[model samples]
Target: MNSPADSGAHRPTPVAVVTGSDSGIGRATAVRLAADGMDIGITWHTDEDGARRTAEEVRAHGRRAAVRHMDLTELPDAADAVDRLAQELGRIDVLVNNAGTGTATPFLDMEYATVRGVLDVDLIGPFLCGQLAARRMIRQGGGGRIVNVTSVHEHQPRVGAAPYCAAKGGLGLLTQVMALELAEHGITVNAVAPGEIATPMTGQEDEDVTSTSRPGVPLGRPGDAREVASVIAFLASEDASYVTGASWVVDGGMLRMGPQAGSHLESDAWRRP
Candidate 1:
């Protein structure tokens, strides 16, 4: 890992807090930030070992790492977790709201409790986290970064995912609102919308995308979690200082299909589960 970024004599070494970083895109993002010279604060929902492993990887990358367990659905005050993490790490330079959940049942088949669960995890949780992080950044007297890990469904509808799509869509707009409100304080807020990434979330943890052939995807392949991390790393860097409130779609052109995707359907295949 690269050495910490030099912020001159008076500035503190940058630190980052990444939620849901036990595995997949979250883990890649934590590692990437650490390699880019930032101490890391990691949180996991149910994966204790995974979170520890992520923390170790950050330390291995020559950056300090702190681990905590955060279950958005169960937390009475989600921001409290952020506060503890920031306090433990001395300061927070960036916040990545990557933890989320989804229900695969059709909209009509979904229960109110299940829908609420998804909303709490994906939308409300990030909202609270972002607010806390912004407050800390304001108090610190320097700009910080907040990157919400929304999904491609934020822009499009999916048959089996109602709450997930709604939550992500809400987050996309929330990101813009945050950017507008936090700009004066020098805090930038943005959303990263990823398509099918080869992560544990997508059950592609053991698959190699390089050798796989996917004719359905425009890129003819699934995305690597690291690819999404690289973009997140850019947003966290000094290079993206002028960029804010934008949704960066790292879907390899999958999003290009919208109203046109239906025109090519051969039969009732799309109606199936």
Candidate 2:
């Protein structure tokens, strides 16, 4: 919560909108940005208490925080949420599209309802948010930052995650297109792809993921939500002005292993034991 009065004698404090920020990486990003002298607009789905906690943490960092309840799967109203936040929080200097949905289902057995839910939240929702944020930034006459929270599945396929992979893959390309179109306007769009972070989404403790010495990861650890937040904070700042349209992988070298190949012998592979 760095105060504008305390930040410096020059420059206006920035305002940031972080979606799905009630918990996990989104929450961390909001706190980090607040510490960096930015007022925060946070959106949450089901966890009002979590969102309130995040807002309190942001305020503790000395920055103003506004909390909003939103359902990102509602595609038509997604952009409206961003617009509302921008109006409420003043000009939005940074937009982090972190809201997403996914479920574990085999591709062949997946229902249209489930697939559409994932796509609407992960891909289409971000599209709407990006459009709205960019429009606001353009009107504000100042360059802004857009950070999309993608996943490693954006680059590689994952079993039992067909729609999730598809949505993230589309989002990866969409981010590049937005960057190309917005760079001339002094706005930069980039993505942060995290792998095996110790978040509720993975249901694994930090120590549990870190202690299992996986053969491929050079770092030999699972990432913390704050670790990913630090990178997002950097990208949203003046320091990352030149960087755009790139997907920075924060996977502790797990992605470098390519597909999960092992020499383990099994009588019937791909079958539940």
| Candidate closest to the true structure, highest lDDT | 1
Per-residue lDDT over 5-26 for candidate 1, one digit per residue giving the tens place of the 0 to 100 score? 5554756789899999999999
Residues forming the 10-long window of minimal summed lDDT in candidate 1: 259-268
RMSD of each: 4.1, 4.7
Tell me, by TM-score, which candidate is best. 1
What C-alpha lDDT do the candidate models reach, one value each?
0.86, 0.84
Reference-based TM-score, model 1: 0.92
Model 2 agreement with the true structure over 52-111: per-residue lDDT tens digits:
999999999888999888897776875587888889987888999998878888889999
Candidate 2 stretches with Cα past 4 Å from truth are 1-11, 205-216, 261-273
On the 0 to 100 scale, the lDDT of residue 126 in model 2 is 94
**How many angstroms is residue 166 displaced in model 1 relative to the true structure, after the best TM-score fit?**
0.3
Query: In model 1, what are the clashing residue pairs, if there are any?
Result: none
**Candidate 1: misplaced stretches above 4 Å?**
1-4, 259-273
Worst 10 residues of 2 by lDDT: 261-270
Candidate 2 clash pair list: 1-61, 1-62, 1-63
